[model samples]
Target: MHKYFTIFKDSYYGYFNYLWSEITTFHWENYFYGLIVVSLLVWGLEILFPWRKNQKIFRKDFWLDTFYMFFNFFLLNLIVLIFLSNATAQLFNDFLGLINLQLSDFQIVNLNALPYGLGLLVFFLVTDFVQWNTHILLHRVPFLWNFHKLHHSVTEMGFAAHLRYHWMEPIVYKSILYIPLAIIGGFDVEAVAIVHFSALTIGHLNHANLGWDYGILKYIFNNPKMHIWHHVKELPENTEYGINYGISLSVWDYIFNTHHVPYDGRDIELGFEDDHEFPLEFTDQIIYPVKKKRSKSA
Candidate 1:
């Protein structure tokens, strides 16, 4: 009994130490590897299992998407980190204070403990749900909609289009979604890393042209079919807004009555009608909305 107890304790401590290390170490190369693999997977799946017969990929699309992806991953992220980190930190602190919540206490279970995995999974699911709801709220609220509509204006749904968001979004919206998780404390760096990769991979997969039907998987995962509907250009046609809202899981949409499935085999045109007049150049997209809003007010 004594020997068995010693073995268990050592294993538990080892796992805990590993988890702690994963949280503290930042590996840029690993992040790049993840981004490349996800992009290729999206491209390959689009070629192999396309959902829309009429949707065509072109070289211009490829280059444009690449530019947006690089810009979002590097420059936009840096801007948010520098300008919004303190604001986000304060918001998180206030939120926790409001809830009177403290960090979850980590208990030592064995290396292969079920509780550890369960805790991590729960944390991931909860965070994704929060993000999905926040995303929906941004769409529904008009002031916030001003910033978010820039994303919806993209008439294309491809790997690169994922980066076509307003600069303020990551700071204002996405930052708040992660703060609760950060405050919880027991969530280690590896879990956070896994969640980030999983969210981006599943989000890209949803944005791809893949033809796979999620079936019941739609209940748990946000597959491509469900998300494509969110990009549908027709006004009333876009009503099925609830499905596949989770960055990875679809459950949040179902739970919140936002889950939508695509019907009507015809290619639902993508992007706003007004977007046609806008310049495709990156600098123009950044300033276009602001100019339009100002013109309208005047």
Candidate 2:
């Protein structure tokens, strides 16, 4: 009991201190500043070369999405997730000790010993592949899709919309990614940070109002032109879940036969078919999925 209490208290203070450092630090790895830099850069691109010319600079639900970004990134994680995750992890570790099992046993190879460039490439590719599969589950799983709908509610996409998602989402992604990353062993922190920032930049651009395919690279990388099709309201024929489930890479979609971009999606209607009745208020949106599931089960 005392251990759980200490974990909760420590996480509360530790998370705030971490946030303060991330904001005060001037170094390249500061995620707070990195988010600001990437967001502004993408917003500039949207301003200079917007594909949706009629959409206003401050598009619909802009402030809402901005709040969702910060809330999901900082506040929600601190207020609820950190304490719970820390406690759960501690409990899991304790249970493993009882069984004389160790997580280290699952590791396969030491990635840090590899050449820097090669290790980074391998790390990026492996992580992105995990992300792509996780993204498909979010779309195909009925229970998970209830939470993921918050992201697709965007009527006018922008850079900030990239971060707008339900609070449970990071849990889903991180929980699934943990084992795969651990198995690779000794991934350099710097390499992971660089890949994270690169992916962040690409994600912002993917949701930006700029229509860019990266030409031939579109086959390898996901771009705004390809991602817009993912948010199209109507389900394409013969497919039920969704298409274009790629994250930072489009190669997986191509390999899995989930890729589909029949034409320019610049003018396509975004959001799910019944999004008209989706809650616009944050509290309502957050509670909606829970209430809906409970009602159905009853």
Candidate 3:
């Protein structure tokens, strides 16, 4: 128990220092700076292209979403995620030890044997496929959707809205992703950072006002045009969870037959049926999922 507690404490300080260094240093691999660059560049595109002509540059809840970006990205890690992830991984390792099992036993492909470039590609694809499945679980599972509802609360989408999800989301996504990625790809820090930045940029583009579908690659990667339908207030008839659950790749949705876009769908309303009554304040939204009145709206 003391060891786990120490692990948590060390993770908190370690992650804080790492984030501080990312902010202070000018490095090619800085995740913090990568966030700012992706945000501004995509916002510039929104300003230039003007997808929804009537939507202002600072659309509704713009600042709110901006705060969410910082909170979910930096502050959340500073407070909880870093320690939780570190501690959980430690505990899981202990459990695996009791059973005399190890990550090596589960390794299907040794990334070290492959060319480093192909190793990176394999890492990105495998993790992304995991996230895509996790995204579907977020919608299909009722309790999970309550937390996910805050993201769906975006009536007017923009680049910043990409990260406006519940803090519980990262815990859920990362928890589901941790083991599979570890088993398949090993812990290639360089590969992880590259995939993260790539997904972050694609996520911004997917939620931005632009309507790009990546031309012929629409079948491969996710873009704003296809992702917009994912926000529609109502899923198409007979749909259970939702459609277009892809995070960084559209191929999953297409292959799973969950893709739906009968029309342009640019002007469609966003959010669940009761979105008007949903909590808007950040604090309220954080607690909204766990409060007594969740199951009704879900």
Using Cα atoms with residue i matched to residue i, what is each candidate's TM-score against the true structure?
0.75, 0.96, 0.96
Q: Model 2: how far is 232 from its true place, Å?
A: 0.4
Tell me the lDDT of candidate 2: 0.89
lDDT of 1 at 268: 68
Instruction: Give model 2's TM-score versus the native structure.
Output: 0.96
Residue-level lDDT of model 3, residues 48-93, one tens digit each, is: 9978999999999999999999899999999999988988788788
Deviating ranges (above 4 Å) for candidate 3: 293-298
Q: lDDT (0-100) at residue 130 of candidate 3?
A: 92
Instruction: Note the residue pairs that clash in candidate 1.
Output: 23-189, 242-258, 242-259, 243-258, 243-259, 243-260
Query: 208, model 1: CA deviation in Å?
Result: 0.7
Candidate 2 regions off by >4 Å?
A: none
Put down candidate 2 lDDT per residue, 1-298, tens digits, no spaces: 9989999999999999999888777888787788888888999999999999999999998889888878887898788889977776687678878999776777787788888888888899999999999999999899999999999999898989999898888888877887787788867667778998999999999999999999999999999999999999997997788999989999999999999999999999899978988899999999878987998999
Model 3 clash pairs are none
- Per-residue lDDT tens digits of candidate 1, residues 1-298? 5644554555455544644454456464355556777888888878776667567865336576787776676555444444355444555556667888532322233222347778777777667767777887777666667766667766656666676677767766666665455444446667767877887878778777666647777777877777776776665544643234456777777776776664742366776556677667768777876887897899
The weakest ten consecutive residues by lDDT in model 3 span 289-298
